[model samples]
Structures are given as structure tokens and as C-alpha cells.
Target chain A: MTLNPNRAAGATPLVAMKDISISFGGIRAVDHVSIDLHAGEVVGLLGHNGAGKSTLIKCLSGAYRMDSGEILIDGEKAEIHNPRDARRYNIETIYQTLALADNLDAASNLFLGRELVTPLGFVDDSRMEAETRRIMGRLNPNFRKFKVPVAALSGGQRQSVAIARAVYFNARILIMDEPTAALGPQETRMVGELIQELKRQGLGIFLISHDIHDVMDLCDRISVMKNGVLVGSEQVGDVTEDEILGMIILGKKPERAGVN
Target chain B: MSDTAEAHGAARKRSFIETLEIDTRLLGMIGAFIVLCLVFHFQTDGRFLTPRNIFTLAIQTVSVAIMATGMVFVIVTRHIDLSVGSLLALCSAVMGMMQVVVMPQMMGMGFGHPLIAPLAILSGVVVGVLIGAFNGWLIGYLTIPSFIVTLGGLLIWRNVAWYLTSGQTIGPLDPTFQLFGGINGTIGPFWSWVVGGLGTAAALWSLWSARRAKQVHGFRVKPAWAELVMGGLVAAAILGFVAIVNAYEVPAARLRRLFEARGETMPEGYTTGYGLPVSVLVLIAVAIAMTVIAKRTRFGRYIFATGGNPDAAELSGINTRLLTVKIFALLGGLCALSAVVASARLTNHANDIGTLDELRVIAAAVIGGTALSGGMGTIYGAILGAIIMQSLQSGMAMVGVDAPFQNIVVGSVLVLAVLIDIIYRKRTGGFK
Candidate 1:
């Protein structure tokens, strides 16, 4: 797939993490990793299991505290002590498990923490349902089950709920960890379309997955990490699937023109 | 074209069946309650349906039902309160000692002083809250498992209650204080009708407003006739209860009738209706408040979320530990209220009061469809469950069943209810 790099050469990156490091029980899980994301772009993080890709992204999502790192949003230092702080900075994450309450309906799950309430301080279900419908219409027009609990929904519909929640909250930077891991091919295509729509709206996304084909098909730039270190970052148009695979398994950068 | 039409019709029919099958456990409870009533009515030669009998049954259900409403929240958040029965005993002991022994002696006033009643109740509830806060802190902030903490509480609180009275029964409560628990202290017939009518109106208004909101939002809603039928059913149930209570004549009028039958003159101005019992009204108010909390409040939603998945709830910015503390404290307050009602009804605080009541309260919640595994329940369902349990005990007693057999039957019914709940969830594809 041909790709055009979305980050302008001189424009400030949307987010930058410098020398982020974290350890678990005396083992370095993520060490000295630096990465950046830009608006209107898709950056794919590819690695093997336990390669520290998830741990690294978790720091940005505020699920984990990095041992040493500086995070900058729009070239300005940002402090994220917890998930609430991350949300305040317009950073929403869609974990592989989706983190939804299984027994609550779609609208309830969508507004789980930040519920809409009336003047009487009661949860306004009707208003929340309306908002959910409006957003789902934009993200996935075919989604119709608003009253059923998420446990009753198909995998793709559950994903739609998770995605719609992130997007509806005006998220500027989204981190999706293996969004299409359990989906069928058709659902995977649907997620791809959703990501493309999000990109068109100028939201920067960090797509974390082990699927090389998905990265080639959807990402503007691919960042490969192996054993807690960044192997290399390359524009998709400048690297082949074999070379990316080589970087993932062998932790070796391909000698490609104009690649860093 | 014909095939397509047939397929559409079948799909519509299937959806209708699906809607009917939703919450089958609730439907099962309703069915079981009706069956129990019929059996008791037949077994007692129609005495079970009498206004007098029904009134007593409602009173009997109120104390446990009140606690069950709070239990719904506790169990919904994946916790248990084995200490409620003991808590009730302790609160009642405190109230009795304050009203009957301490307050009168300290103030040099008679026990019948009206001030004594409210003061005793307040102190009782305050003590309950303090104890509950202690329990909440241990389980929530200290990270102790609720099961172990509450199990320990069950033993400790009961011992404290026993120690408070030194195994002596406190009795013959003040007349003014007894009114809260006695039948003669009930509201009159006129006010019962007024309250019932207002309750019906509120129910209808809520239904209509919900429909209007759905329409305004352009969301799919039930058909107009379906809503109308639901409203009518609720109204009938409320009106029927009022009619039953109104049928019971006052004890003074009955005494006057007996005197007249003996060919003697009767006292004038002895006319009155049984009206509604004070405790029953209290239970109704608690039920309404709890239902609203469970269905429409953020705290209620957090309870369910915490039960559904603690990790997700915390990651969503909810403080699950703090929520746990608040829920336990609320349960404690409910326990205090139950103590007030129980003590007032019997006009005494005995060592055996509230014995084994925690088991009954938990059974009622489980029968009402509150899962022990957590994440799903309703306050109304818990109330109905309490009614079902009381009905069984009342029916079996009227039928002259042995006490041990009654225990066996009640235990079996509880196990059967949970088994049915599991099957119903599986049939409906609910999360286990």
C-alpha cells in the first residue's frame, strides 16, 4: 500500500515521549524508548508478546507511571498521574478487553464515569441514549442495539461502543491496543474504516498490534519495538513487510533511503 | 415477495417473544407469590385473605424488607452483610436502654415523655452508623475481604447486644414510643386513600414523562397501548392494596359490636377504619427511595459497575473502595431503622430479637433475583422477595406445620430460587 507521511517536516508533533523507562520487579519492562505522534496520522507500534510495546503505551495512557520520562503535548510538558488526568488531556484508550461493564446497556457503558445528569442530579438516561445514538450514527451507522447490555452485543458492536465512547468525548489522541484482535475479517475492515474516519477528522492515533499486514494497510508511519527498545521508525511507503518483520524479530533496522 | 413478507413477520414475532422472556426470574417470583397466596387461602379456609390477616402479614414483612433494600446494594457491589441481624439486635438494645432506663433516670422525667422517643431513635441510628463506618473502613480502606469482616462482625455485635442487657429483656415501652410500632398508631382511612391516590398519580406521571423523553430523543419506544396497559396494572395494584387495608374495621368498633350483641348499650363515637400501619408506610417510603437510587442515581450506577468489573470501574475513574464504604454505612443505617420497627412492634428488646435474621434477609434478596455473584438486582425485587418469604412462613404456620418442617421448607425454597435464577439467566443469555 502506498502511503503519504502525515507529519509535516517542520510542524510540531502532537505528542512526544522522551526516554521513557519503567521496570517491574527488578526487570526493565520498558527502557529508554522515545516516540512521537502527529495530528491526522496513524502510528503503528508492532512487537512480539512481552516486547514491552504494551507497557510503553500504558505509560502514555497513564495506566502505568514511567520511571524516567518527559511527555510533551504540542511541544509543551504534560503531567498525567492517572487515567483521569489522561482523559483531561484528551487522551482516550481502547484496551484489548474494551474495559466495559458487561451488564450495562450501551448508553450506560458509554457514559459510565462521566454520566449526564438532570437538574435533580439523577442520571438522565434519555439524554444519554440520544447522545449515544448521535455518535454511533457517525462512527458505525449500522449499530442499532442501544438498549441491550454490552454482553449481548456482537464483538464488533462492543468495539463500536468503545470507539464511540472515545470519539464522543472529543479525544485528540487515541491509543487502541489490539482493537481488532478478536474480530473476523469483516469486523477488522470495519475498524479500519473507523480509524480512517478518525484520521480524516485530524485525531492522532497510536495503533498497537502484532499484525504486520494491518500496520502496512493502515499506518502512515510504523515504529517497531523489540525487548524494550525502539528498533527504528520508518514511513510505510519506504519499507516492505519483510523488512519490518526482520526488524521485529531480529531487532535490526533495514537500510532504507530517507529512513531513521 | 411472499418469502420476504413471511420472513419479516417471523422476525417480528420472535422479537415479541424475546421481550416477554426478558427478566424471567422476576416473573417467576410473581408467579410463586400468587401460588403461595392461593395455597394459604385454601388451607386456612379463606382466613388467609382476610384484611386482618393480610395487615399482620404486611407488618411482619416490613422489618426484613427494609433491610433487604439495603442488602440489594451491598450484594450488588459483590459484598455480603452477615452482621445486619446482630447489628439490629445491638441497635434495639441501645434504643431500649436509652428510652426505658437511661433517659428517664437522667432527665428525672417519666418514660412517656415525647422527647424520649425521638432522642432514643436518633441515638440508636447514630450508633449504628458509627459501627457501620468501622466495618466500612476495615473492608474498604484496610483492604480486608467483606465476607471475613462481616462474618466476624456477626459474632461480635451479637455478643455486644447480649452484654448490653446482661441477658435481661427490656419491656413495656412508653405509650408515645410504642405508637411507631403498634397497629392503633396507624393513619386513618381518609389519609390512606389520599396517599394511595397520590402514589398512583406519581407513577402515571413518571411513565408518561419517560415516554415523552424517548419520543423527543427519537429513540424506539414501546407502543402506546403497551405503556397504557403497564400503567393500568400498577394503578390497580396500588388501589387494591388500599381497598384491602380499608376493609379492616378498628378494634374499638369491633368491641362496640360485641357489646351490642350482648343486649347492652355501646359507647358512642367508636367508628374508624384500620387505615395503614406506620411501619408499613415507612417500608413503602424506603422502597421508593431505594428504587430511585438504584435506577436513577450515579452512586447506584457505580455500585453495579463495581460489581460488574472492579478493574474497569477503577480505570474509569470511580473510587470503588470509597463506594464500598458508603454502601456498608447505608446498610448499617437500614439495620438501625429495622431495629426501631422491630422493638416498637413487640414493645420490648429481648435477647432473642433479630436472631438468625441475617439469613432471612440474604435469602429474600437472593429470591428476588439479586445474584450472590453480584452485578444485578432491583430494590422492588428484594421487597417482593421478603414478602414471598414471610408469606411462606405465615402460610405454613396457619396450616399447623411443625416449626422444624417450616425451616426445612424455607431453606429448600431458597435453594430452589437460586437454582431457578441460574437457569433463567442461562436461558436469557445473561452474564453468569
Candidate 2:
């Protein structure tokens, strides 16, 4: 395992994962991987399919139990053993499919797991609806509320609802998996803007994307991986698409090694 | 503006295929209703629409409709309760046996007096709730598929009912017990009109309030006029039904007339308005209550969420197992209640009571737009579905269709309903 770079100037890392290793059937999927994310920073996790990027994130999200690792949130050591534990640490994940129930509209989805109840012992739908409108007004102004089922909503609107569900629950760390996958250019941009807004709210985002362009445009830091190993983490402004591609192809970061 | 208007007009003129593609269940239900009307219209020389037959129709639909109300909840959570029929039979048999055994014992103990009927109802409810809880625990906490659990329960509970009754009919219930199955005294249909009118008004008010809240919040709201139109149609249907029912004698009155052949005349002009059958009122209340709970409560919302996508619901932190158990328990309790009403009406709780009703209850829910795959259905729709089934049975019988033929007709109707549901789903892109 290689050492992480020093924090630049006054910017402290919001999260530092050190010596993370996980295996399946004695085969290392994430072998001694280490990464850091800063407050209000968008860090892109980039690798080819099956290059262990997802496995590493799943470990961080408590979807997979890590064999060995030390995770620090805001420089404090933390253990996340399950999704509930992750939630307690204010970590939220929005899967690529959005996972919103199509039959329930935005308000219902916004409060899907934790609904506001009235004093009368029923679901305070009115309160939920009002809260949904308020949150959506800040998140995605174009969202519609009158729809009985969300099946009628556009894909971007659906994603907005899913993101709003996580954000409304006070998530400090947002993990988005291919947020713009399968979306049109307009919807993609819409999600990109939403992600930026979340960043402005001071959330540290771990964005997993296959599109190198998306990473270059939206991410502040890019971490490249190959074959269950971390190649290098570079500032997006300092790295090129081809350089990252080389790291993915050669299983070693040439630029970091001063060999490029 | 003109171009936009023209585009909108073009969209409106899209093919029926497109409409079917958008709302498969709607088309399927409408199509089924049309087919049923056509068949009944052709069969009894149009007597199916007569007041007497319609009165009979309400009575025939009550028990199934009531049970279907709860079955909607069970089905919505992607579960089935086969023990519902058995539960009903057990409740009725217990109630019947209690009249002979438990009630006399109470009288002997000097604790009953006039409390026997109330005690009987209480016992029925407690038994139902306990059975429901047991079923829920088995399916939800034990991680058994509901079908297997309820199927085993269905056989076991029916055997219990038979064993309790010694495989004989238990009957001659207290007159107060029979009151549940009898019609309330008639008020020339005025009471039905008043109650139905109030119900419609309440519905309209809630719809208006919901829309108002949406508009005030600048949320994309359903059009006010559209809801008003739909509510108006429903209100009109209720008013029309009241008028039709008010014009006819309740089934209880008819039964009384048959009893009058032995020189006993029913009280002059006895009527229960359109509220003739207490079971009908029970069915309506159950339907409304379940609908409100499913559409308006957090737990109800969870039921749909769990049914539609269990993984997501679980991720959201819902106790999905607990919800399943609660829903199954509700179904069991409701089935027991239905059994009491129905058995009392029959004047006996036979070991064979509630037999084959499970198929009808499930069939009604499935036909009423409940998805076998879960996360889609309504209690109101289930009631409508039950009505369609009951109408077919009653209309065929009115035209002299024998029991064997009636079974064939019903079986075919159930199959047709499923076929229509499938076709509707395919047309509407329910499955991708």
C-alpha cells in the first residue's frame, strides 16, 4: 500500500480510508486500497467494470464487511457495519436505478422510510406533501406533485426524488452510483446541477461514474483504480483523460510514479 | 398557442391502443363490466336490471365484498390469505356452537342475561384476531411464503371448524344475532340517500382539500375539474342505486313473506331503505375504511411500498416483516367478521360453510385490479370486482342457471379476468 498525499494548505480531508482490504472466496477485490475525500469536494471513483471500484464503495457504505481497514470521518475513527450504521454516520447512497417506488409520488418517496405522522395516528400526508414541496423547491423546482404515481415522472424527476429522499434525511456524505447513467444530456445536466447544489451544502460526495468526461467536468478529485488496487488519486485539474486511462489499462499510475 | 393547442389535440386523438397502454387496469375493468352487462342483458330477457334482482344483488355481494376488502390489504403486500375462508367458517361455527353450548352455560352461570349476543361478537373478534396474529407470525417472522402458510391454515382451520361442530350444522341463533343479517327497518330509502349523499360530499371535500393544498404549495396538482367530474359520477351512481333499492323490498322482507305462509304477516310496509341489508352496510364501511387506511396512512403506504418493491422499503428502514404480519392479521380478523354475518344469515353454521370462498376472494382482488405481483390495488376496486362476480352469479341464477352451470360460469369469468389483466398489463407497459 502507498501513502496518501498530504493535505494542501488549510483544506483538511473530511474522510480518510486507510489500508482497506476486502476479499471474496480468497480473491482480493479491494486489496489494501486507500483514499481520502475533502469537505465539499466531489471525488470520482473511476475504473473499468469489475475493477473493484464498486466493491470498495460498497465496503465504505457497509454493504460489504471489510476484512481490514481504518475509516476516519472528520479525522475520527468510525466503524460502519451495516446500512443502519452507515445511516447513523450520515452516509446515504443513491443507486443507479434511483430505487423510487413508481406508485408513490415525490412526497411519498421523499418520506418513504421515515414519514411524518400527525397527532391523530395516521400518516400526515399533508405535512409530508408540504415538506416535499419545500425541499423540492430548493432541490428541483421543476418537480410535479399532483401525480398519484411517480411512473409518470421523467427519469430526471425520479432521480431528483430519490436524491431528495437521501438529502432530506440529513446525509452529510452522499454516494451516487452512475447518477447520470441512461439519462439524456438535459437530464444528465440536471443531475449534475443537483450534485453541485449538494456540494454547496457542504456534503462530501463519492461519485461513481464510467463517463470520464463527467468525472473531469464535475469532480474536484479523481481516484483511478485497476484490478482491485488503487492506482492513484489526482486533482482533476492536474490530470488528463488519457493519463487516467493509462492507469486503468496498465494497473499502475505512471504519472504518480514519475514514469510517464 | 395555436400550435400547442393543435399538438395537444393530436395527443388527445391517440389510439385506444395508446389509452390501453397508459391504464391497463382501467380498460380491463371497463371491458369486463361491459361484457357482463351484455351477457346479463341477453340472458334474463333483461330482468337482471329489475329492482328485485338488483336488491338480491346487494345481498349476494355483501359477504364476498366484505372479505375482499381485507384481502386487498393482504394482496397489496404481495401475500395471500387462504385461511380467510376457513377463518370465516370457524367464526360462524364458533358463534353457532356458542349459542347452543357457551350461551346456555353463561345463562346457567347467571352472567349472560342479555349479554350473550355481545359476548358472541366479542368472542368472534378475539378468535379472529388471535388466528390472524398466528398466521402473521408464521409468515412474517418465520419467513414462510404466505401462500404455504395460509394454505396449511386453510385446511387446518376448516378441520377445526368441522371438529368443533362434530361435522354437523349448528344453528337457531338468538334473534339479536340474526339482526346482523336482517334488514334495518325501511325509511323509504331516505336514510340511504342521506348517508350516501353525505359520503359523497365528504369524498368531494377531501379531494378538494388535497387539491387546494397542492395548488397552494405550487405543486403540480391534479386538475380540479377532473376530480369533480369523477366525484360527480360516483355520487350519481350512489344516488341512482339508492333510488333503485328504495323502490324494492329488502331480502329480509321477502324472506318474511315466505314465512307468512303459515299465517304470520310481516309488519306493514317494513323497509330498510337501500340500507336493507346490514351486511351491505358492513361491506361499504369496510371498503371505505380500508381504502382510507391504504391511501392515507403511513402504515398503508408501507404496505404498498413493501409490495411494489420490498428491497427499497427495507432500505428505507420500514419493518417490513411486522407490516406483513399486521396485514395478515387484519385479513384474518375481517374474514372472521364476514363469516359471522354470513353464517347468521344462513341460520346455520355448517361444517361446509365458507368452502371455496377463498378462490372467490382472491379472484375478486385479482380481478379488481390488484396485481398478483403486488404494490397495486384498492379496496374500492376490490368491492367493484366482487360486485361483478356476484352479479354474474345472481343474474345467471335469476335466469334459471343451475348450480353446476353457475360454477362453470364463475370459473370461466375468473380465468377471463386474469387474461384481461394480463393483456391490460402488456398494453400499458406494466412489465418492461
Candidate 3:
């Protein structure tokens, strides 16, 4: 998905990319893609299943390094060679499976690798519990607390925990891969509310999803891509579903008509 | 009642009531302990519980129990340290050589304060750790399976241990070292009772703390009320065990009479009682420490994560390789510690220092509820399992049970533990 610079806002772009490219083996999965995520903005990357959306996001998340082009974080050129480096850049990613320890509960999942430890040098359960309660209160107040293991949590609650984990670590850019892919209507709405909360916190969210309606409802700007190329980015209010579809299929912006 | 309704009601009650039942592993160990006691008590016509007889049991069981504690950690990580027995033998041989060759040389050099015994022990630990680290590095970083690494380690270490002493017995250790393993009686057996009580209390406290933390953090905590009641019962059981062991004594007041009959002087606390073996105290301490680490530490959590899903752990930013190495090194150090204790008790070090010890140690860990596949276990359970096995060996010997029969019985117990574990996994939807 390409970023459009015409729509200026008060929030600064946390991540600015210029002509990033990544190829696996001999296949160019992502090519010459430019994306900018402003603070407190939800940018939905719209594409077909193989439209290079995931490949591009993976490069940003540091799962794969770009073959060419530069990435700037807050206008500073950043080198992200690994996931750990991406985390240091405040780029937290939530994959489709949630990538959580099923045997561990919400608190443990929230602080999986980086746990709150006590003075005695053990995993500090009390403090972790208090912190989990506070964060869940803000992001998902209705989430049940008794189920400690992630295995027992519902789809929405598990996503909430994964999101909460990234947020708790002070994530500035959240890359969500189909956060509501397997959820029911009510659960999807719950996630929608969560995305809104993150947006209010000035977090730049790059949501990659197949649901166009979800993109229209939540994203500030929608970028369509097809065949490893950026089609165009348009303000959600200005673009119709047909126009977005056309951009995805043809890799070019459709002509604007006189209709409202 | 209608047949279908009756069956449904019965199933509901069974499901509800089953939660209160003792876990199968615990049940198995306790059952084994009781049956052994009964067999020995009946066969010996109640003479097996005599103070002298009980002390014999203490010494007999210490070596296996110590090894089992270390085995618990390795097994929990879904790895096997087949080198423990080899490490044990090697360490003891080093200690023996220090006592026989090095100390005498030091004494000849006019060094009044001979440091060979202590130095030998330290060397043993270092050697064990280094070998363990080597094995750990191979298995952890190189992504080798634990069984293969430890199997290779077993051969290498056992040969080293054998070569260290020229495959011969080396003995006549310092009196101080001997006292640790020997001197089964002291201060009227009160010290043993105190140690037991303190040990049991510490176990209870740590168990409570772990469960409390799990509850607070919203971890999958066991039922609190059940845990508390179980803790109290275990504490009380220790107290009761102390009372029973004390009762088994010939009476301290009577010990003086035997001495008087022979017109000989006696040491303090010489009066007869089961009194604690230093080995037993060491065993209990190891158990408590292991439980704390496995349940409450970040390292322990990593161990579980590594076992449950290595890929997921790696993705979570855990150094799975490093964790595996640390666990193996811990196994080696623990085995060395056990070797030191065992040598102190035997008052000798030899080629057969830890003969067939692997079977007993691994058996204890397995029987204690540690999964051979890893990801679930308790140190306390491992200790209980070791104690049960040791008791069986001692009790059977006391009852004049044939050696072949004892071996068969122990083998059956091991097989039964594995079977019980299988059933548990099935019942619990394959606890991983």
C-alpha cells in the first residue's frame, strides 16, 4: 500500500518508507512500495491474497529485510535486521495465530518474554496481575479475568491479550495481521473498539485485512495494491468500494466522476 | 431410577469427586511406600522398624534420592542426562584419589592443613559442570537431541571416571568427610526430628507461595483450599513420621545400659534412635530448592516453554539453546553434589561408585510424575518417588527378600509409573 502526502494532519508519520523492495529466492514478492503511517492513524492495506501486502508488512516488522530502499522512523533512518531490532524501534507485530503461549494465561502472555520480576528474582505474579487488570480495563474491560491460560480464552479475548502485550511494552506502531479473521460479529466489533482505543493513544496502526467493510469503517486512509505494486492511496471519504476494487485489479487509479 | 439417568448422575458425581482425589503419581508413590513397609514389617515380625534398622535404610536410600533430584530437572526439560551416574562415579574417584594420594603427599610436604578433600570435591564439581556444559552446548545450540548427547556423554564420562582411578577402589577418606555419611546418630536423635520438621515446613511454605502467585497472576492455579489442606496434611505427615522413627529407637535411656554392660564410654546422643542421615537432610534440602526453582523462576518457565514448543519459545525471543545448556550444566553439578554426599557416606570411592544408579535415578524422576516427554513435573514428586523406591529396596532387604525378586519388584514399579503417566495423559487430554 502506498501513502498519499496530500492529506496533511497534525500527527507526524512514525514510519516513512521510500521504494522498499523484497524478493524471496527469485520471486519479487514486494516491489517499490512506499507507505507512511502517521501517529494516531489507521492505514488499511487493501489487496488480494497474493497482492504483496503481507510481504511488505513483514519487511517493516523485520521478519524480512528489504532488498532495497530506506525506512525512516520518526524521520531517522532505521536498520531493522531482526525482530528484536524492530521491537527496539517500537514496532510490535501481532500475527494471525496471536503467537501466544497457549498454556500461559493473560498476564503471562502479556509479558511472555519480558516478565515483571520480583525483588527476590522470581516472576512477580502480584504486580503482573495488577498491571494486567489495569491494561485490560482500558483496552477490554469486559474480558474475563479468571481464565489464566490463553488456551481457555475466546478468540476476541486472545486477540485482546496479544494486543495488550504489544501496547504494554509501549508500542508506537502496531502491525496487526487479520486481528478479527476468525471472530464472530460481536467479537469483531470488540476488536474494532480496541483498534480505536489504540488509535486514540497515538499509535500508528497498519492493519492488513481482507474485509473491505472493516477497512472502510476503521481506516483513515486506504491503500490498494496489486501484483507487487502500489495502486494508490485515497481518503476513505473520497474513494468508493468500486474504485478501490478497480485500483486493486488494474494497478491504476480509476477516473473520478461528478457523482457525490 | 431409569438406567440412563442413573448412569448420567453417576458420571457427573464421579467427575466432580475426581478433582479431590490424590493425583495418580502421588497415589502410586504412597502406595509403594506403604506396601514395602507392610512387607518388611510382617516378614521381619516388626523388627524392621527398629532404630538400627531404620538408620540402615537412611544410608541405603541417600545416593538414589540425591541423583533423582537432579534427574527431575533434566527430565522436566524433556531431556535426559545419562551422564549423571558417570559424573557421580568420576567425582567420587577424584575425592578418593585426593584422600589416598594427594593428601598424603601434602602431609609429607609438611602442610599440616591438608586441602585435598575439599579441593577434590571442588574439582569434581568443576569437571561435572564443564562436561555438562559441553553436552548442553551440543544439544542446545547445535540442536541435537538430549538423549543422543547425554548418551555419548555417559560413555565419555564413565570412561573418564574409570580412567581417573585406573578402574580401582580408592578409599580411607578424611574422618571429617566420613562423619557426613557415617555418624547417623547425634544429640539423642532430636537433630533429625528438627531437620525433618524444618524441611517439611519449608516445603509447605514454598508450595503455598507458588500457588498463591499463580492465583494472583491469574495463572492456572490449583484449587487453593485443596492446596492448603494438602500442605497441612503433608506437614503433619512429616511430624508423624518423626514420631514414628523416634519410636523405632531402642530408647536413648536404654543405650546407656548397653554401654554400661560393656563398661564402655559413649558419645553424646549415642542412645539408640533412627536419627537422621546427613544424606537425608541433604536430599530434603535439594528437593525444596528444586521445587522453588522449577515453580517460581524465569529460568524454570523458560524450561517449560522450551519443552512445550521450541519454535514458539524461539519466536518469543527466548534463547532456547542457552536454556538447554544451563539445564544440562545444572544436571551435571547436581550429580557431582550427590556423588560427594554418597562418597562421604560410603567412606570409600570405587569403580562401582554408581553402578546401575541411572536406572534408579531416572526411575525415581519418572515415577515422581516427571514426563519423559517433558513439560510437566514436580521436584517434590520426584523426591517422593525416590524415597518410595529406596524404601522398597531397604524394606525388602530387611525382610530377607531375594535379590532377584527385589529387582523384579523395582522393575515392575517403574513400568507401573509409566503406565500411570499414560493414563494421566489420556485423562487430562494429554498434558504436555
Report the lDDT of model 2 for residue B89: 90
Q: Model 2 off-target regions past 4 Å? A: A1-13, A16-36, A59-72, A75-85, A116-148, A224-243, A253-260, B1-42, B45-47, B97-99, B106-112, B182-201, B218-232, B243-245, B250-275, B425-432
Candidate 2 docking DockQ = 0.31
**What is model 3's interface RMSD?**
8.4
Candidate 3 on A1-260: residue-level lDDT in tens?
22334336554568888798988888888889898888888989989998999889888887778999989998899998767688889898888766776656677667767878988898875677779888998888876643345665678888888888888999999999888997889989988988988888888899999998999899988778888888878777788888877787777686873121
Report RMSD for candidate 1: 3.9
Sliding window of 10 residues with minimal summed lDDT for model 3 chain B: B1-10
Q: DockQ of candidate 1?
A: 0.43
Q: Which candidate is the best by DockQ?
A: 1
Best by lDDT: 1
Error of 2 at B77 (Å): 3.0
lDDT of 2 by residue, A1-260 (tens): 11223345555578888999999998999999999887678999999998888899977777788999988988899898866678778888888877777667678877887788867777877678788878888888866543356765678878888898878998888899898896889999988998888887888899999999899888888888888998888877666778878877786665454311
What is the Å distance of residue A98 in model 3 from its true position?
2.9
TM-score of 2: 0.82
Ten residues in sequence with the least summed lDDT for candidate 3 chain A: A1-10
lDDT of 3 by residue, B281-400 (tens): 666677767766876788877777666555556566677778878888887877787887888877788777787788888988888888877667777787778777887777777777
Q: In terms of TM-score, which candidate is strongest?
A: 1
